[model samples]
Target: MAFRDLAMAMVYFSQTLIGTVGNVLLLYHCSCLHFTKSKLRPTDLILKHLLVANSLVILFRGVPETMAAFGLKDFLSDLGCKLVLYVHRVGRGVSIGSTCLLSVFQVITISPRNSRWTDLKLTAPEYVSIISILCWILHMLLNTIVLMYVTDRRCHKNITYRKEFEYCSTIRQQKSRTILHAALLFLPDALCVGLMLWTSSSMISILYRHKLRMQHVRKTNFTQRSSPETKATKTIILLVSTFVCFYSLSSIFQALFTLYNNPDRFLVNVAAVVTGGYPTVSPFLLIKHFPCISNLTDCVRNKKTYNVKRIMQLS
Candidate 1:
């Protein structure tokens, strides 16, 4: 391989490894909680689902690109290509749906007692399993077109039949089919985006009102008092924003690849990287925002602070 290709391969290898390990840790943490805890919190419910979705995304999306980066593009058979690409697409769709659910659930969970959604907080926990299963089935059905369209592009001497794949060919679609499926997929994506925006906005507004009320009641300088719910909201917001940013970036790059006859290999890699980037980074962000984790960090900081004091006393 050329120096550039080798470097790209290394980049992908490192990212995939990091992403895999991070997601595995997340999965392990959630699994332990699920099995050991008496009851799963709603937040944990969403998080566990998100972790599974992210792991699949990282595995399916990152592995192929990493292999391709190292110059092993033609290794997949037609059936293998179909299965890999189909699973990857389904994983991405599930991740999107899971994020939307998490965001909306947090908003509802934190809603004011008198608010319209207040009643949902009690009932939402019951529906989590059903909603998640529906999300899986819905996305699975929506993306089955991949099975029909994704074929091995490696040995195709006829370039016309080739579809776009992550490391290889993707689903070959004509203008009509492309437009139709895009519309179908966009309906859910658009719904998710809309729901996330509204829920996030509502939570922000609630926070603002809450702060003002606290200030009024105290009649003193406002200090930040964050609840566990607030922390979860922040985590959900960060995950949503990160997912949306990467999702858009990857889509734009993919679009550009289709538009241009000769697209840069670096751009392709960047797009592929963005595809797996959020799944890589989101677990760390989630861990960072957890109340227990933050408290543990604070304890460590305090221990260090005390150690410094002891050293000074000894001196």
Candidate 2:
């Protein structure tokens, strides 16, 4: 393999490994909490969904791309190609949807009680699980259209097909039909991204106001230390910002690839890397702020204390 290919493969391999491990660890922690009957916040439930979606995105996208980068060929069957691409599309949609939902939830959470959103703030937690389930269903149904287009690269060598990935080829369609399909796929993602932008702006506004109020009341400089709400809001804002940046770059690369008559391997590789950026990075952001670490530490401390008490009693 060329140096460029080797480098790209290494990048994908690193992203896949780190992202998968981080998501799984956090997911396992969340599951343990659920099974142990620990109280979970509404945000926690949304986060669990996000983690699962991120894991799917990383695994399906990263693994295949890495293999392809390493000069693998015709490894997937037609069914395998369809399944991999379909799941990747669904996972990407769900990841976007989940992030949008999380932002909306945070905005509702931090809204002033006297505001018009009070009722939603009161009731949103009850519906988080339902909303997350609906997101998954919506994406699953929407991406079924992908199955009709995607096939293994080797399956259609004699026919004219657009090479979407190293292992996946998509049947070319009429211009109008292709446009329609593009619109159908783009609309939902656009809606979710728009929602995220709006919610993130609102959160920034709310945080600013809260900061001002705190500074006024305390008559001192607001330090790095902040309330849990402020910290959570900041984290979501950062998350949304990161998603928007990476998503926009990936979209631009994809558009260029589509418009060009013959896109280079570098363009395709860059797009794949940009596409996987959010999934690979977001998990670490979440893991840093996740309460699971503290919970685990507390459990260990309690266990040690109990053992010491037993030893004392025996002596």
Candidate 3:
């Protein structure tokens, strides 16, 4: 393999392994086995869904990109491409929806009691299942069109108009169908990003005001800034920021590919880099926020270090 391909393979492998491991651990802790509480928070419910989505994204995206880096071509059959790409898109759409829901719920949770959204805070947990079902239904419906163009046909014969999926042949769609396809893919993305921005901004505002109130009340005393609501809002903001950055970068590369009719390897690599950002960063951000996770991480790290030291002494 060329140096570039080797580097890309390293990036893909490391991100895939780290992201999958962290997200799996997060899922386990947030599942029925909660060491810290008897009941899960509404946001925790949303996060469970996000973890599943991120795991799927990591698997489909990381595996293909790594195989391509090592010069493995056409490893997927027609049915495999359809299933893998469909699941990837669905997972991505669910991730976007879950992030939006998480942000909105956090905003409601922190809103003043007399605010218009107060009712949602009290009842958000009840609607979690409904929201998850709607998200899956919407994405599954939107992604059904994937079956039309994804195939195992040879694509190198006409490289000028072909989009570069690892194991799929590109087929031309009608103009009207193309517009509808774009709408189906990008409409929900735009809505999710807009909603997240609005809600996350509101959360930051509420957090700032709360900080000011705390400062006023405890001007003469030392106070902790680590209230549960405060910490949760901060985590939401970090997650949203990471998502926006990666999503924007990927979309820009995609637009460039479309404008130029086909992208070279470098642009494709840049796009691939964006795919790993959120799945890798989110788990660590969440780990620091949850006390249970923090304790778990410390114990694991200590044990691993002890094993390494013992191995060195033996060697």
Q: In order, what lDDT does every prediction score?
A: 0.78, 0.85, 0.80
Backbone clash pairs for candidate 2 read none
Give, for candidate 2, the lowest lDDT window spanning 10 residues.
216-225
- Model 1 Cα lDDT, one tens digit per residue, 1-315: 899878878878888889878777666655544443435677677777777888888888778887887788788888888788788888888888899999988889888999999789789989998899899999999998777666776655565645454355664567898779778877898799889888888888887887777876654434556777777787888888888888788878868976765577778878878888988898888877554443445444555666687789999
lDDT of 2: 0.85
Best candidate per TM-score, number? 2
How many pairs collide in each candidate, listed in order?
5, 0, 0
lDDT tens string, model 2, 1-315? Answer: 899889999999998998888788788778656655567899889988899899888999999999998999678999999899899999999999999999999999999999778999878998999999999999999899899878887773666647556767778777898789888889999999999999999999888887777776754446556878888888999999999999999889978877874578788888888888998888777765767654677644555666687789999
Candidate 1 residues lying further than 4 Å off, grouped into runs, are 155-167, 219-224, 291-315
Worst ten in a row by lDDT for model 3? 31-40
Assess candidate 1 and give its TM-score to the true structure.
0.86
Off by over 4 Å in 2: 156-158, 219-224, 294-315
lDDT of 3 at 138: 96
Residue range 257-298, candidate 3, lDDT tens digits:
667645687877778768777877788888876665656665
Q: Which candidate, 1 or 2, would have the higher lDDT against the true structure? A: 2
